[model samples]
Target: MSKLIDPIASVEDDTKSPVSVPSSPKDSPRTPIVALKHKHEDKPLSRSSSLLDMLHLKDVHIPTPPAVKFAPLNVPRHRRLQTAVVATWAFMIPICLTVFYGSLIFSKWLRPLAVAYAIWFVLFDRAWVHRGGRRQEWIRRSAFWKNFAAYYPITTVKEADLPADGKYVFGYHPHGIISMGAACTFATESTGFSELFPGVVCHLLTLDANFWIPFYRDILMGMGLSSVSKRSCRSILKMGRSICIVIGGASESLYAYPGTNDLTLKKRLGFIKIAIREGASLVPVYGFGENDIYELLPNEKGTMTYRFQKWFQSTFGFTVPLFHGRSVFTYNYGLMPYRRPVTVVVGSPIAVKQIDKPTDEEVQAVHKEYIEALQALWDKYKDKYAKDRKSELKLVD
Candidate 1:
């Protein structure tokens, strides 16, 4: 075997060099020199070192950091499957777009079908806008979604059983970066939503702009997502079907920092008004650990970043947040969300009486009750699920 060397000893040896000693104390310099000459003179200069040398920084010695640790090739099959499923869901939009365009371009037979679909989507396809989009039970019950949910291992906790006879409105809170919890829990049946509340079908509401995408829109509609517009919500409620809405929307996503539960719900009265008008019971669903999966950059109010985000939202009706998560091969950083357990708790329903036209006072009264119900839900489960939470829930505008 080769001889072993101590790193500390090697560093000491490399640093040590011969220094000339003076015979008299008066001839010696005030400060003793550790190394009078450059020690790396004999070694060939690296490209970075040469550039630094040209800048008269020959004496500078920058330490090199250790390389990032990546997942080994011998990872478990289940783990690989989980990563693959999550990656597919994460990049589904671009993948769908590419496939849609590529098929039309490469295959001559698909162009006619593509043109007809485009015309219908632009002119007459109001399923996403009216009647809660066509939901295919087969697609909603696909095994693929189970694998996707298993990646985050998302679970749904039903506090009380909602009767099928009652129409309901679920207000999903603290919109996480991409509302992963909301999507997995409501948009898909991966979390056993159907079994938990039998006969109570839920259509998750999203922005109207999302339906503009070609192939991606079909996937969303198939998953039982509809537009969040006033008309769509009213229409869905009229049909006696329940709907789930992420109350915070894009504004709340900006404040989606880990361990924080700040919600932008102070002035949100539209959902409350609609519920009152349609006699839909309001259910507050909180997804504990929703904001913990991704790390978001600080863009506090009054800052340039925050101002710009607000401006962009005003201009485009949506805002893009600067956030990051772990990658498939590494835990340090990428678009893939960290493997964090997200528990979505569906709370008790708050009853509302139907009104022809709810006044401001009536709306405010219902809004207060809704807020209290949501707060109670948070207080009840924060200790159990949010033990690592940095702060209590706050309803910020």
Candidate 2:
């Protein structure tokens, strides 16, 4: 049996991150090992190495010796702490911004409008940033680090174990409240994505409606985000290096209650079918804390929230992912999740032999294997991140 690895605690659980410069192996005690099976025919691949090799994916390494001289905000701990503060500070934005403009638009009488504006940003603006006018390349990159600093900080634990030449389909599970961590970590070159996982380029997939947002549309394109539409998936898989999809989307968001591992996925198979057609290896990813950040209203099947979301989906083709966190004054920790740690483990890849469109059984079989891969990832890393988890993982229908 392969023993699982708890990424967070396995390494220094409380160690602060090193910023800017990458560390040489000598400065660090633990280094990225290369015991992977590169010999192909002659030798068997080491579990981690061989798995990564098969999918054309690579593990990330956390730089050590803390590059203090080159970076000011380089420490990973600061990144985590500051991220919460920023989310809280963003609450102050409408006050400052509105005060600046309200005086002009409404004069001395409507000064409180600034607060209203900030509330608007929190309640409405954050679902996804698709505003139509701004230049987003900078935001995509900066947003990458901003989020990295805010939530779970990750590094490629090892080198790329896959062939330098190949294509892939990366399936990210447990679509956290926003799948925001996935966005910052994989979709863009920011947060050292390429530095961590080289050889394969990743395209983060999202809703087709997102393309309608003005500025956000430009931003996502630059980050290489594509539509989650089946046609788009086929095109992306054919394009080849790599592409990522949240797999369980809006519907998944409804099951965001804490202490549970219900994945609002089972019937969703367009991405999997696309993968079979493209002949790409399937990679399973599970992010701990994806669901723990906020307390969502109970939206069970017959609840008003659930009914509304379903109606909304039928009418708009998109369902409302209802969740709640904090509001500046009302929430001390705020809707912004507290500083609990979130770790995203990239599981070993499940290789797919070339084949035609998969049959129902074939799809179910692949999905079953995919679920196992995801379960293994959880089993391996759970103790580290979810040591306090109330119950073992479960696959809720």
Candidate 3:
């Protein structure tokens, strides 16, 4: 079982005040110290007194309770705007649904338009499935994404330049809580990915289920995000554009505890097969401080919580993790992730030979090489970016 360290109690200390005694103790037999009496010490305890106080536990030192720090009213407008954009992004799915359904219900005149749109979405919407989504360069370069990236202050570090002519598959590691780093870096232009790696147009790939949401689907497509289905990947690579996949997927998200880099990669060979078959260069991207944005509840393996979460993922396509972060109003607890810096370091691409039908051994060989590159990347940046990590980078199945 994994142990969870208390972030609050780690910084607290117990102090003892020195008591002065008479100098005569050196020459004479030690005399028992008499308690100094105060007039109030003899007074009867009130009803409001705690049990410890009533029991005369006067020597006990009680630590002050932890208090939530609320956001100050004088916060800068730009910072507030950043928070608003982040909050909107966080709750975007529900917000879109509400807007869609609310418009149909409240605005009676728009019902026919809504029906038309729904029919078109159901029958003709292949944007999410093919050609790497309806990628709007202007939307990807919007100021909105810049603020979104500033929420975590996400940055992209390019170790080697990727050529424009080559097709590439970016394997994003450690699938941190929502893969926020991946979304900000690849889905949007928040991280200046285009400038960092000029000429390489990248699309962030997500689950097919995400495209099922009405308005949210359009928003995701507009930001250059596509479905992670094999067909979608092939279509994108065929067009000579690259795609970034959170290789760990939903299963890895269960291990997203703060300060840990436990990735589910040993048995993940699908991305490797895709890379080899499509003849795309494999790039390993690690997001440092990705898991430190939120604290997860104890759901270690063998526990019911862990079992249920695993069962849900196996039964459905995703699982819910019990996590908490600071709120918009207060800094103690809420759904808003902590404003931690996420530095996404893009490692040098490993060129793969195009194989029509790769054997298991060949796939494993490529997978091994990819793992080494990812590990080397971690080793290089762990000290500088992941100094606070609790454990070294681990590739857990």
lDDT of 1: 0.87
Instruction: Using TM-score, give the best candidate's number.
Output: 3
User: What lDDT score goes with residue 191 in model 2?
Assistant: 54
CA shift at 68, candidate 2, in angstroms? 37
Q: Using lDDT as the measure, which candidate wins? A: 1
TM-score of each: 0.83, 0.63, 0.83
Candidate 3 has which clashing residue pairs, if any?
none
Q: All candidates: CA RMSD in angstroms? A: 9.1, 24.1, 11.6
* lDDT per residue as tens, model 3, 1-397: 2333323211112253323345577645878443333234753343344455545544545555456689889989998999998888888999989888887778888877877888898899998887777889888888988998898889989999899899899999879788888888898788888888889988999999988888899888998999999999988998889999999999888899999999999899998999999999999999998898888888989999999998999999988888988877887678988899999999999999999899999999999999999999999999999988899999789
lDDT of 2 by residue, 1-397 (tens): 2343323312222344322222567765676444333333334343333344444333433333222222234457755455654464444444444545755477756556645654564466532323211324565566535555454443322212544466677777678677755766676544566665667666787886765543345456666677776666666666555777887787777776766667866677776777777888888877777777676767888978889998888798767666666432333324555445556666667787667857998888888888877787888778877777767776665
Assess each prediction's global lDDT (C-alpha) against the native. Answer: 0.87, 0.62, 0.86
User: In angstroms, what RMSD does candidate 2 have relative to the true structure?
Assistant: 24.1
Among all windows of 10 consecutive residues in model 3, the one with the lowest summed lDDT is 5-14
Position 177, candidate 1: lDDT: 92
Per-residue alpha-carbon lDDT of model 1 for 1-397, expressed as tens digits? 2343322211223343335445556776575433233355543333223344435455555544334558789988887898998988889888977877876788789878877888899899989888788888888888888888888779999999899999999999889999889998888888999999999989999998889888889889998899999999999999989999999999999999999999999999999999999999999999999999898988988999999999999999999899988788887668899889899999999999999799999999999999999999999999999999999999789
